[model samples]
Target: MGERVQTVIVGAGVIGLAIARALAQAGREVIVLERHGLIGSEVSSRNSEVIHAGIYYATDWLKTRLCVAGRKKLYPYLESHGVAHRKIGKLIVACDQEQLAKLSGIMEGARVNGVDDLRLVSAEEVHEMEPHLACTGAILSPSTGIVDAHGLMLALRGDAEAAGAMIAFNAPLEGGRILDDGIALDVGGETPMSLVADEVVIAAGLGAQDAAAAIEGYPAEAVPPIHRIKGNYFALSGKSPFERLIYPVPVHGGLGIHATLDLSGRVKFGPDVDWDAEPAYDVDPARGEVFYEAVRSYWPGLPDGALAPDYAGVRPKLTARGEPARDFVIEGPETHGVAGLVGLFGIESPGLTSSLAVADHVAALLGYGKAQ
Candidate 1:
């Protein structure tokens, strides 16, 4: 028999780390099994790192609730813990009259979703805020910001470890069996081992579906189809043109390719959605062509050959191609008939913004603590 733990969280990404912290803080014995040698090596590090303001989601969606709540919870924690971050705000621009009219609906939807701080600004205001921007109108989201994601993860790991949560890096979940009172997991690493966990949470970002399938006795029908979309980011060679983040109105399958700044005020444009079969992190040079056209829509002064491939992140979408995006699917015993197992699916954008709330929800689903 292998070691027995009160809880075993698969994946040590932000959400997994947050969940470990929450559960460990609740006096539960937690062990985080990470396939990679370091935490945040996958989806956690490969993201826009922007803190969303819960504006784009529907009124009743989990993304809206968790993102808003998580953003609210995150700012204070980041400040209190001395995490580097900036609430520099964001601008959603509309270049044409048709797109400009869509801004109202976006604003209305944001309001319905409890994000009342978003304000519609005229073309003059947009230009005043960002002279290089050429939009007819814009929606300013004051609550949106950027954060040092790795620093935040370090804090979460510290908290979890302080609370007795043990993180075993390089221990990938190979497969598992659902035991009578708990689940057994086969973990692969430098030294292979087996573990029996009273509770299990599959928060594997891109590997979520595979993690679910690895668990024996899990309902096959409950596993949703996954679609992978590669979002690539491009770095600017010169000084950033704008102070605040600039985003065009959303497009099919994603928020349009937008420009965002890091904590150091360096600008990068990205994440143009490219459907793919497998995960690819390479930033193709040819893809830079599309970014120039996209960025020029908002900033016409963009210089040719100034854009270069920077980094890329893959979004594991739960919705199929051409299908409307779906909500965060957090399945617990109620859905799978498996006691003490929860799987997170379709946690893409707003996931970083919603990490804490997602953790609280997952912990509450396991009957550990209240989601606040």
Candidate 2:
């Protein structure tokens, strides 16, 4: 709004908004610029709002660290704010002997990642926990749950606004250039205007790389290539019979098709992995055929036509096809020699759970201490 502020955060997704709140809470003036009319319109609003238990990632990686730490921070925040959520827990089911072999490895991974309370359950115990689920073995994650993502975002916005952070909607960042004075932003629109700031944090999610390209002197190589990975969901029409979230053994690149329950107890299954170069968000009802087969593997009583196209989300993956998946890339001035600027890429799964920790990490990059 004014000529300048202490910081400018690009993108209004959960990550961006959370970062803005953290910075403002640290007593720095902040402004969040969003291209959409409302916040969380992109990856934030689309994904399964599952709070990931620290599993499937290497112990030392940022994904594992942030997810574990953020979960500790988020649960209390949600409860204190009156946001709708359920600690419904989750089960990593083993459909057969081959899958059963992998359960031990998963438990070891979870333990090393500082996740306690992950216990291996036998077929009998699984029946006791979920009578309708068909499985030979399972790993119970009591900390995993779901949140009303939109509601969580609203609370975050309220906190940020209350702390004096300003947000401008429909304000797409056109470009920017680093100067001796400060960083200058060219916000594109009918009333295109330029503003300066001491520091800029780019939390643009899928658009992070593109936004980085717009800034002169920012290295192209430093901006990781953005790959869009599509995940599809199917909503169950009938009342939910299951009480907790159900998942499959950890699969490379994703947690396989599983059942998830919302705060209202509505059941849904989905987010089967599909990679697309151009990336389409539309959910194809025909995919329900595939979902039916997957869901029936664990729940035999699923009725026909009950599973319908629910929604879809695209992951802002940093790796390309045939390449190994990389951890979160939060490039800052030290990496690219662009002072007062930071870029976030590949903030995908577990991102929702890792939102607060990610915000703290970004703030530290800008030389701000953790908010007390």
Who wins the lDDT comparison?
Answer: 1
Q: What is candidate 2's lDDT per residue for 180-273, written digit by digit as tens?
A: 7678888975566788988898899888888888877678888888888888989999889798999987666788888988888888787888
- lDDT against the true structure, each candidate: 0.90, 0.87
Q: What is the TM-score of each candidate against the true structure?
A: 0.98, 0.96
- Candidate 2 — which pairs collide? none
The TM-score measured for candidate 1 stands at: 0.98
lDDT of 2: 0.87
CA displacement after TM-score superposition, residue 248 of candidate 2 (Å): 0.8
lDDT of 1 by residue, 142-220 (tens): 9999999999999999999999999999898999999998999999989899899999999998898999899999898
